[model samples]
Target chain A: MNFDFGFAIVAAVIVVSALFVVRAANLIHAVLWLGVTLLGTAALYAQLNAPFLAGVQVLTYVGGVVTLMIFGVMVTRRHDGIDVVAQTEGADRGFIFASALFVVLALVTWKSAPHVPNPAPVASSADIARALLGEYLIGFEVLSLLLLAAIVGAVVLVRRRDPEPAGEPSPAAAAVSEVNP
Target chain B: MNEFLQGGLYGGGIIVAIMSSLLFVLWTERKMAARMQSRIGPTFTDPLGFLQAPADVLKLLQKEDIIPEKADRALFNNAPLLGATVAIAGAAVVPFSATIVGADLEVGVLYLLAVGALGVLPVFAAGWGSNNKFALLGAMRAIAQSVSYEVPLVLAALVPVILAGSMKLSDIVAYQSSHHWLVVWPFFLGIPAFGLFMLAMLAESNRIPFDIPEAESELVAGITTEYTGMKFGLFYMAEYLHTVIASAVASALFLGGYDGPIAPGLWWMVLKTGLLVVAIYWLRWSLLRFRSDQLMALCWRWLVPSGVVLVVGAAVWVVFAG
Candidate 1:
């Protein structure tokens, strides 16, 4: 198959999924649509001869990030039913803003597209690894430290503030006592 | 054009082989479980109940399909197919022998890890689409469990990649053949990494001790609570396929995949994978399931830290020993 044809298909899928991600009424559906868009972007990465980036895209973005988003959606949802509609207002203004941004992006792309190279050879994982560990070692270490700090912050934010007293009756026990009384 | 056809044929052959072998594996799992429990498993189906797997599949295929009224029709319909497809896709880069692989991408190990991770999406889709509380809970557990275990899984797999100096599965295997199998290398680090890999694999595939997602006693089949007929069959097939793929990857990474004494070939790979599969099944029948809190603690508290240490240890070993 022609690479252009494959790229076109992947691009189309990515664009459609991106649209659906914003357009889907249900929160879960929007998350799923975002997943498709991310996966399609990963496909684009693979087509661009960056398989390692593609894998990381799928691994971290689709798997870890999206799963976390879905878990958050599931947990924070107020309604018990899965059909809860996500409130999405102010579409006209959003659309106007999006269109202006798209226009700017398109203009920038059209102006700078001529400078981009064609058919670049894929950078294998080894080369990327070597560059990260050797040439960009400090930057890589710093980025990891940043991520570690973020994780620590997240854990601290979510952790229970204080342990309940062992002698104190739990909520369930209290509720049962009230009901029985 | 010729390459495309060759690739198609190779992939098709691998899928068929996997499906057929899945039947036998399912039967073997049942028989093994039954033997462990001291019961006559599926004796009425065929000779020694060997045909039970096909029979079960046929029954599932013939059953009337059911879709709940509240379910998201499109996603509910598509989820099973997605699960099975992604599960089978992980096998693409695994080399059965020197010449046998569906696709030998430069980042084969990453490809395997990536594809394995995709199994979570369909499962989440199924759970949400089902519009059932139990299914949603199950899906939530599955996503949490799989995503958490993936950390250690990738880390353990990376030990082999670092030692081999390549992300290619074939290269890792070849590295093992030249050196010692990774499960025996560096004595301390290799064994720990291998054990960690096995634990992560079990958790990733939702096997026993990590199967809180599908605990039948509590969740009633978990995310598959609303599925019926062949849709349910697809989920079953996906689970088994995921197990097999995990075993194949473990074998490739640590057990000297397709490498053995006297002209190593496909059989060695199969034998190693088979042994892992049996071990998984044996553990399934023997071990008790973990509570959700315990499972998460194990992953975050134990496996994750140990995996980091193992990776650092492997890198140090490579620097010193290589």
Candidate 2:
């Protein structure tokens, strides 16, 4: 198969999945569709000769981020009903805002370069590592620090202030006490 | 076109090999577990139940396919196939020998890790699509467990990549062959990273001590609770296939891959992988499962930090020694 043909197919899949991600009535389906979109983007990265980036994209975005999103959807959903349809609101304003953003994006792309473009040289993983650890060492360190801060913040937010006493009734036990008392 | 055809043939051969090997792995795991538990495992079918895997597959194939009434039909049906595909794909970049890889990509290690990461999605799909609360809970636990461990897994895998100065599996193995197997080289860092990698592998494959996702006593087979027949068989196959892939990757990275004293070749890779598989099976039968909190704690509080240290240590060693 021709490379361009493969790229075109991947692009089509991305577009279709991106549409489904927003249009799907069910939140879980939308999240799954979003995964498909991310997978297509990873394919695009592969096609562009950045296989390392492609792998990282799949690893971080599809594997980590999308899975977390699905977990969030599952946890936050009301369990009283099956297949809760996600509510859609502000269609008119949302469309107007989306269209304006698209226009701006298109204008920026058009203004930047209209001529036939040469593919960027693909950097090996080693080269990327060298660049990060050498030239961009400070940036890399800062990014790590930022991630560490975020992790610490998340842990602090979720950490319990005090441990529950051993003799204290559990939530289920408390419910029983309420019923029996 | 010639390369494509050659690749196609090799890919087909690899898939067939993986499937056949999975049968042997399942049989061995059963016999081992049975022996450990002081019970005779499968023996009636063919020579110590060697054919049990095929027999089980055939039985599943013949069973009625039942989709739950409230299930999302498309996802419910497709999840098992997707799971198997992801599981098998993790083996593609693994170098069995100098010339035996399916796709010797530049980022082979990262590719394997990425594909391995995709395994959780199909389980989540099965859980959500099944429309069963138990399945959903199982999927939730599986995803959380897998994602949490992947942090340490990637970090630990990076130790070898740092030592080798390349993300290619071939390069990593070649580095081990020239210097020493990663498990012994820079013994302090390599050993700990290997340990962490093995722990993560167990969690990643949902084996014992990390099999919370499908705790039979609690979740009634977890995500597979709603699955029936061949679909369930596919999930089982995926799990075994993943364990084998993890073993092969571990062999390549930490055990000098196909390198051996007497004429290094495919057998060396196979032998090393077999040993690791036995270790994994041994652990599965011997260990008790971890609570969810304990599992998360082990990953975050211990493995992740140790992995980071290993990576940094490897980087420093590489710079100073080289």
Candidate 3:
């Protein structure tokens, strides 16, 4: 309820992790850091009154999407080659200006931020259920339908189009079998 | 009694209880494993292996904490802590009884499911940090299994949620106590829902049969292949904790948690959970490891459909009953 130092530290970690995700050089590193950012956000959401949404965010966004994106990047690239695509060319003056601006914003925020009060007592899950099923039943059902559609779309999108015959396994599979045997 | 649980002190106490439960469950699990193998299990220390967990903890603490010379020492060191911490955070919402729980938050069920779901990150972190081929493969397998099973687990869980008309664990428990256990009234449907829930929990925890991620014969402990001493111990603890929590959840949802004529509240809850744990272990030993493809197909094809049917059936039943 009262602002615990622990929660503040966690908040800082989450914020810093988000910054790292943006600044990290490697795509893999960025994705991993993004996981940290997502987790931090989920924690923050938990601290708020939205544990369900937080769970959904972490499960779907962090757990599902981020993993898929990382796998996609890895599978698409040359596994051995490290291509450091230079996103920010020499912009030292701009970077310094942006840093100064960020510092000012941080100082202003720190100075003016009101003391956060104790956490309010949250509604029980029953309240949420009553609202969803009683009033928002159609919306809930529609959401379910959308989820089904999304799963179908994902299956269609990721389907192996070539239809490779079962008799001829991929070279990697063959090599794996040889080694295992 | 519920008012006391709503207070801060009891909240903290519940945290301590869950943590101790995690430790005690591990000792029990080891003893069980030893018994199954016909070997003496930590009997020399505590007469009945009661203090075995504490002794094991002390041993782990005393072991030389070594970082691999080539490892990303920071990530490698932190990974176990992350795993353990996330696993602990999951306990906050698990309703042990009518009045015994931590943080009866609005999103209780979802919070438990989500936070528990994040166990994959630490698995990946450990795999990637160690930079071992086996750990990587194990980590990948874990992630795949997690994805495969997650759908069914959530879907099956939704049946109770739909029936209870709440995602709160407390509400679900209360609903069960007031009505019969969902298992009793809807007798046949309960089998599929509980079956799907238990199977998914197994895959989620990376336990036997569903434990290809750490398949000893194939992957040499999978994602945790390279971990040693306490770092390894933490992952082990998280796993046991996951198992205990999964069993608690399954029983809580389907088997009428803390509900019986003879036993006290917590005792009733623990007894139900223990029975579920044994059943899970029995299942693990009886079934062989499913091939990853078969595992995926089983979840996607069989469990998911069953889960959907469960939710729809429950929803219909709830409407009519109301």
Candidate 4:
């Protein structure tokens, strides 16, 4: 567990999947690549001893967000050729420039940060639960309330219109969201 | 190196055990479903068709692997394998008894939920790759069902974790062996949580009553529409395997796993898991399937709220009583 073999492999997976996410032409494939990237990130979190964080990463990003993204893609009139960003001219120059900028940012942050690749695994689940429930209880509850507000707002904003006057094919596309029940 | 090899071998053994048990699960479902429907089921494969599932699996696998001409090659070829792989991987954290486990992860409960969530990806991938509209629709249904049900499922699972005060499956079991089973203790908290867990389990595994994702009449086998041969077989196996693994988790979380009298701990664990598996099949046969709309409504309107209340109640109970 202390060795870098696992870290290197997981990092490679994350980088490759993220690259594919950017380069994939098909919308669904891109979403799937995003999922793979999220999973790889979760693996890295586990290696860093943030097992709880890793689990939630997979549960929320790969599981919830990505699934919704997939449904969003599928419910659209078309699933393919949705990703044209990678196909347009001048994209390579932009990508290369972005990569270079990202490398520089990584180097700058690496120099300043405390390097604790093998921290003593102090951030266990119990410690987190205690701190959140005891010291930060108010903050946690408030954040939860904020999330609930967001949900309510979204539902209200997108409240379904009354049934289209008879004989119309119906906006069953809206119901396609029911795909994700 | 030696410890690694031993661990690998032990994990391999668990997988083999799970695989073999699938046959028994299949047999029981057949006999049970038949009895429920008042019709005869397979009675010939291996002395009352005991090995009929494996036989059917063999037949399905031997058929020619058919890749649709327009299918996305990479995803179409690999998604079912991924589905089956995820199901087996989730089992790694499940303590079959006091001693047997592939990896007793400290955060085992969360890991199981994560892997369970990962199950949605493969179905969507398969659907997208198939280039078939109905497959897309079915995959969409699966994603929706899993994602929706996952909310209540996680909250319900957390009730046990909250009661035991640990996310480790073995610790949860130990807690139950010493105290009461979480499903029985905490006064009125356990039953609702367990009920919610059972419902979510049915939906998560796409079992009957929640099988709208593969409603045969509607979507032509849903996500497996374009699959043939072993690939199709793999998807079906994954469904059964998901339920089996989920049952193991449920037994560990709710039943007093391995706590029965006059038997080795492993045997009791196996017995409880077997019963839970059969009970799930009974549930599937006894109920009618949910239409996709009703499915969502049931989840959002009933199960999720119940789960939240149960979780809060369990947490409060753990603090005051336990």
lDDT tens string, model 1, B1-322?
Answer: 6988988898999999988889878888999989899987998876699888888889999999999998999899999999999989989999999999888889998888888788899999999999999998998899889988999998998888888899989988999999989877766877888889989988988888889999999999999999999999999899899899889888888889999987799999999999999999998888888879779989999999999999999899899987
Interface RMSD of each: 0.7, 0.6, 2.2, 0.6
Task: Give a tens-digit lDDT track for model 1, residues A108-156.
Answer: 9999987888777767777898899999999999999999999899999
What's model 4's TM-score?
0.90
lDDT of each: 0.89, 0.89, 0.78, 0.85
In CAPRI terms, model 3 is classed as: medium
Q: Name the runs in model 4 displaced over 4 angstroms.
A: A1-3, A76-89, A113-117, A163-181
**lDDT score at residue B276, model 3, on the 0-100 scale:** 84
RMSD of 3: 5.3
lDDT of 2 at B70: 94
lDDT of 3 by residue, B1-322 (tens): 5776547677678767777886667666677777787886788776888887888888988888777787767678888999988877777777787777777765677876777577777877888778788888998888888877888888888888887777777778878788878788777667778888888888887888888888788888887777888998999888777777778888878878777766537788898888887777667656778777768878888888888888888778778864
Highest-DockQ candidate: 4
Shift of residue B21 alpha carbon in model 2, Å: 1.0
RMSD (CA, angstroms), candidate 1: 4.1
Cα-based lDDT at residue A138, candidate 1 = 100
**Candidate 1 collision pairs:** none
Query: Which candidate order results from sorting by TM-score in descending order?
Result: 1, 2, 4, 3
Q: Judge candidate 1 at residue B80 and give its lDDT.
A: 96
Candidate 4 chain A lowest-lDDT run of ten: A77-86
> Candidate 4 — what's its lDDT?
0.85
Better of 1 and 4 by DockQ: 4
> Which portions of model 1 miss their true places by more than 4 Å?
A1-3, A79-84, A87-93, A164-181
True-structure RMSD, every candidate? 4.1, 4.3, 5.3, 4.6
